[model samples]
Target chain A: MAAAVETASHIRAARRGSIRGSRRKALFWSYFFLVLFVVIFLAPPFYMLITSLKSSGEISAQVNPWWVFHPTLENYLGLLTEPNFVTFFRNSAVVSLCVVAISMLISVPAAFALARMKFWGSATLATGVFLTYLIPESLLFIPFFRIFAFLRDITGIEFLNHWWVLIIVYPTLSVPFCTWILISYFASIPKELDEAALIDGAGYIQMLTKIFIPVALPGIIAATIFAFTVAWADFLYPLAFTTSADQLVLPVGIVTTLIKGDVYNWGQIMAGSLICAAPPLIIYAFLMDYYIAGLTAGATKG
Target chain B: MAEAVMSGVRAPAARRSSLRAIARRKPMIAFMMALPLILLILLLVVYPALYSIHLATLNRSMKRFVGFGNFLFLFKRDTFWMVVKQSVIFACTAVFFKTLIGIFLANFVHTIPTKGQRKWRGMLMVSWVIPTAISSITWFWLFDPSYSAFNWLLAKFFGTAPIPWLGEPLWARFCVILVNIWAGTPFFMIMYLAALKSVPEQLYEAAAIDGANWWQRLWYVTLPMMRNIISITVLFSLIVTFANFDIVRILTNGGPVDQTQIFATWAFQVGIQGNDIPLGASVSLFMFPILGVSAYFILRGVRRRSQEI
Candidate 1:
């Protein structure tokens, strides 16, 4: 009787183990779909890498169009060594860095005031600032062209096709959004910190420097990254404003120089693009969480 | 101890700490702190925007007021109507797909346990955080007629004829919209995911206990719960897609035959390319009313929901 009972129990355990194995297979299929989704989404950049690595002849001959052959570093080498590409990179770096510095200079204090001070029209002004983001860059270019022309004529200082032209243009894009983000972050800080600082006879400036700046460091970093990326990757403004190859940023630079008229130098074009995309890709790989936090803050608040 | 406590309260009360005293001292410092941003916005955004409007009304030479003549001329053009229709089509179709796919993906990803959440979330955000212009170029390459991997894959899998992804007008429009959707949907995915996480599991549990299936649970519990985020995201996406220029420009440069010309691209053509400043301003300014209405509803919806929550 004991032997029969033990055999029956073992059979039951075996059946249960197989059923559990099938359930695991179902979960695997579900994960497979998610993995496939990522591959499809990531195809363009991956394809870009392959194309950038191929030689011009291979790209043109179209032998197994998806595969890279005679893998060469020629295009990257050429791009990096080219004087014009170097100039474009330099100009982009300068514009992006300056925009970050200038944007922070303006946005931080404005955020402080809006968060702390009970000023007249402060709420109205905050809303107004966000509305500025709705205005497209396409609209701004024409008026900018005319205004710059007028400035050149009056002040005898030529602003068109110059790097400094971006210095003037970028703030229009960065300042409003940065201020809104900074304001939101500052407001979320506890009121007691400022009260304690005030009790210590710390002035507003002292409080901003001593209390707010260190606390809101992540928001500031996120804003800086934003300002940098906007100034770096902006295409329309550079396309319209800068006609000179020497003055162009990466986006307009690669398109105009490599793919002209009807002939696309696909290999070199892809190579130039990868170089241009490197910085932001690196920034993103490191700081993606902070970036998303900054972007969604407005939505959550609104 | 009682005497010391009384002395402390009396000593603190002996000094005047009036609101007027604080304001009198810190008003200058507050203004000083705020002065830079005020000046920057005034010079850059506020002044240029107003100046642009002023310049749009006046003649090209700015010597005389044209008095809506440029706007009138814009209305007279055949291309303007074509652009309007195309813009609506682009924004609506793109927003539709983005919201649909975004919500679907969010739901799919959410079915996984919390431990597996971060991996998928990171993958979804990859498309979003990459700079727009760079990714647009990558898409541009992928849609190239003679050498697109998308077509190559299609050929390999199905033995189909090569479709001119950007050569034909309708196909070109579809391609542009497809790329726009691809680039944009990740944004919606993240937003929906955040909203989905906030949805209490008890509602789903209660619904399931009452005999609701997956579809029913999604319809009743998920949809209603995510309504505010959905509406706001749709509105915001609509606005951005309408104003979008990069994807369209990079993909087809406004088309095989101006078939993909939305308002923003059309504005670029007429304003800067055609040297018709007033016309471009008028075209761009057309976006204002739609933007205003959407902004109103979105802000109101958010406020109402937040109060409820």
Candidate 2:
């Protein structure tokens, strides 16, 4: 009996050891592939930084493109001082801010109504908002282009080729998604808090401002980040609508003005691209949790 | 005693009337709140979408109505068919690889200790966080024919000749799709990771006890649990990838004899740049059928998920 019990216990211990051994092996491979993917994923931006630091002459000389042996800050200095680059930066900032403001102003109230109040067609309207969010800007830009031209012809308002026009166009892209996101957020808030606020004689607008907005601040931040990113990163609208160098936003400006036809200025171009990419990247870095939460919420919590 | 009874009855009646008034006022207030959103959608999204159809029916000069003329023109052209083929291929290939890579990376990230996952995830997501236009420019530089970094490394390590990345049609298409995969895979990774986290660990343990291997566990356990999210993510990525413009525009511009032209770029080329608005509108409208179908699936998926919850 004692010998049999010893054998059984020894067998159990061996099994446990093998299981742990397999787990360790799995973990080692996981980290191995994770490091591999991370390198591949980050290569471009890393390359951009590397290239941006090199002078034009060094870039042209082709002395090991991977490393910048004699790195220079001329590309950064040049773009910073360049009026066109500054104008592009300013235009992108203004457009992004205005779009975010407009998106919030429109989406918050709409989301509140749809999520809380049972109005006529509110459910269908909410679904409609989601469907509209799926409509790519590529599909709409053509008609928008013609419409702006038609308006220009009829009212002489000069709607085309101006950066401010982007402020108007961008909300159409942002508001629907923002409203959809906020509706889900507002819907997730428990029913009791709003009921208590209503019992306290809070008006519809007052309840929305005092109760819903603060509680859903994370959602609001996520939505704002999304709106700002959409506005800032938009290439099609700004590319198609605004063509003048002075009126162009960062993405379009950097691409069109910096390249200057086949004579690609790699240093300044990379520098400009890096600068253009900064705001969204910084926002993502800080508010990553909110951003990821918002992203998953769209699919999982819908 | 008569005064007390009368006052109590009057108070109940007054409270009922106020409640009814609040109920009556709710719809109007809701309408007022939703008015801006409604107007924006009606005037901007719905109107332009329908207007594009009407615009497609018009002649290039807009003086005459030529129903289906532009589409007929497109049907007769090889480039139009090429655009359709390339667009489908690009969307399909990119989404497939993205989904595969995403699931693998998500599983990898999931296997690691929770403490280290955040750092790894953040690092992996840098490619996606950068704007596509900016990143595509970097890619374009990397694929530059004369001074290609990829080729430089290839020559140093493997003694390979410089590749004509964008100068050749096939390579251009490959480069565009590769850049897209690079930019988009991180999104799939993040989404799948979230889904992975939600999957109950007990299910995997059960599979392991039943003598399921790693692949079997993934096949039987992980994929089944993540089916809804996978479909949703794939569908979403499909729509976006099909309509992608920036990568193609900045990287190749549908160049090397227009071999890399997708619907978006082709539309831009024909409509905006080519000075044929009707033709461009028609080209863009081709995206509608696919987009509409995917959008339908997404709506259904969202509704079902919401219902399930």
Worst ten in a row by lDDT for model 1 chain A = A18-27
lDDT by residue (tens digit), candidate 2, B62-106: 889999888898899999999999999999999999999999999
TM-score of each: 0.90, 0.96
* Residue B60 displacement in candidate 1 (angstroms): 5.2
Q: How far is candidate 2 from the true structure (C-alpha RMSD, Å)?
A: 5.4
Q: Would you list the C-alpha lDDT of every candidate in the order shown?
A: 0.78, 0.89
RMSD vs true structure, all candidates: 6.4, 5.4
Q: Return the interface RMSD of the candidates, in order shown, one decimal each.
A: 8.0, 8.6
Query: Residues A159-273, candidate 1, lDDT per residue (tens digit)?
Result: 8988779988988788888887787778777776876676677777888899889998888878888898889888888877888889888888887777777877787788888
- Candidate 1's docking class is acceptable
RMSD of model 1 against the true structure: 6.4
Q: Point out where model 2 deviates above 4 Å.
A: A1-11, B1-18
DockQ of each: 0.33, 0.55
lDDT of 2 at A222: 90
Q: Runs in model 1 with CA error above 4 Å?
A: A1-33, B1-20, B59-63, B305-309
